[model samples]
Target: MPSPRPSLTLTLLQARETAMRFFRPQLNLHDLTEQQWRVIRILRQQGELENHQLARLACILKPSMSGVLARLQRDGLVGRRRMLEDQRRVLVSLTEQGEQCFASMSLEMEKNYQRIQQQMGEEKLATLLELLRELRGVKP
Candidate 1:
């Protein structure tokens, strides 16, 4: 028989859902969907990226990225430009409006993170992050 509370996938999903509960309201306040916010946040941090690179880093499917990007572009939150040296290579970046939105959201997100850290204790939170990175195969 399967042991209760022993499924890795289920535990991960539960953790994600719990965190999203806190973040969803913030996303709604910004009038942004999760995927849109993910795109904006990554663009804000990385400056410029190819659509595929952005999609991969944001954990968004490549097919879905085009639509997300289109909406963000229509909303004036993202810009797409072809490379001068390689015209076929399209690069994407956040616009000034996007930057402003990101800055505002970042403040609230950081506050939420601090709350979680306080609840869990800073050391435990750090250790959890370390273990998660290990599970994700990210180099320390």
Candidate 2:
């Protein structure tokens, strides 16, 4: 017998792709992968963070985060340094150029967000966001 309901995991992934379609062009233009942008966005908002903290907030695995940070550092978008007080801890921060890139890209990103809001209606979008947050809090 066929299940009547769609797979929730697959549906969520599809929904993410649909949303990403709006912003992927800006990312491509900036030569940033999704992980790189997520790291930059978090660092821009949170200031310097320990490497593990950054990976957690960015939802990127530790192994993959090393490559993402390397690419960003190579492009002069990010910097990494060992904490002076805690020699074993590494901190990551965005460079000046990274901030400038974020500022420029944010305009386009905001416009795309506004377009999505307009298409969906502000109230519904807000409700959807709240619902998504609640859903994320669910556990098996």
Candidate 3:
């Protein structure tokens, strides 16, 4: 008889899908895609960053970041300005609308986090975080 393969990959995939279910509804309320929301959240936490920096912070590729910036600019949620020292370099920042949207969405995101934490409890949550960090080769 063949032994069962490890289920870690399946568990990770399922967890990701479940988390998206929680995120999708909140994102839809703000008319934001998951990638867009990720960008906004990264900006909120990291402050202003250039396009390439933002892409790195958001874990997205440069081409996708370009599209996200275009959409954000078109929606008046983000603004860009040439760097004073280097005209070729562009700095990106959130507009008033973007800040306001992030503030609202942040609350929603917090609530989701809290709900999960409560469901899992502190011990399990800590273990989960430790496991995830180890998986990513990050020391806890």
Candidate 4:
């Protein structure tokens, strides 16, 4: 028989799925995939980044990032620019439309977070965030 202890990895995934349940519908309304949203969110928060850096920050593989970036550029949501000083470096950032998309969706996202806070209790939510960071070996 399996051990009484549940899998931590599976529990983390289930928790993520439960949370995405709230965000997914809002993402769908904008015709954005999870990957695209991740890309947009990172760019919006962190400003311009190279493909490799963006790939790392977004947890997207290099090949997948190419395709995702292509689709985003095609959709007018993101743009890649060559650095003025170093032509070899390419940086990616959200376009105006992408900013607008985030602006529009952020209200709903914040409201969902508020609901989650209400359900989990503000202190518990804060503790969970802190614990998750600690679990990742990150200091506050």
The candidate that wins on TM-score is 2
Taking the tens digit of each residue's C-alpha lDDT, what string does model 1 give over 1-140?
A: 96687888899999999878878989999899999999998998888999989999999999999999999999999999999999998999999999988988898999889888888999999999999988999555
The candidate, 2 or 4, that scores higher on TM-score is 2
Expressed as tens digits, the lDDT of each residue in 1-140 for candidate 2 is 97689888899899889889999999999988999999999999999999999999999999999999999999999999998898999999999999998999999999999989999999999999999999989998
- The weakest ten consecutive residues by lDDT in model 4 span 131-140
RMSD of each: 2.5, 1.2, 2.7, 2.5
Error of 2 at 86 (Å): 1.8
On residues 1-140, what C-alpha lDDT tens digit does candidate 3 reach at each position? 99998798899999988878877889999999888888888877787899889988787899988999999889988889999999988988888999999988888888888888898898998999898978988456
Q: Using lDDT as the measure, what is the rank order of every candidate, best first? A: 4, 2, 1, 3
Error of 4 at 110 (Å): 0.6
Candidate 4, residue 80: how far the Cα is off, in Å: 0.3
Tell me how many clashing residue pairs each candidate has: 0, 0, 0, 0
What are the per-residue Cα lDDT tens digits for candidate 4 across 31-131? 99999999999999999899999999888999999999999999999999999999998999999999999999999999999989999999999999999
Q: How well does each candidate superpose onto the true structure, as a TM-score?
A: 0.92, 0.94, 0.85, 0.91
TM-score of 3: 0.85
CA deviation > 4 Å runs, candidate 3? 1-10, 138-140
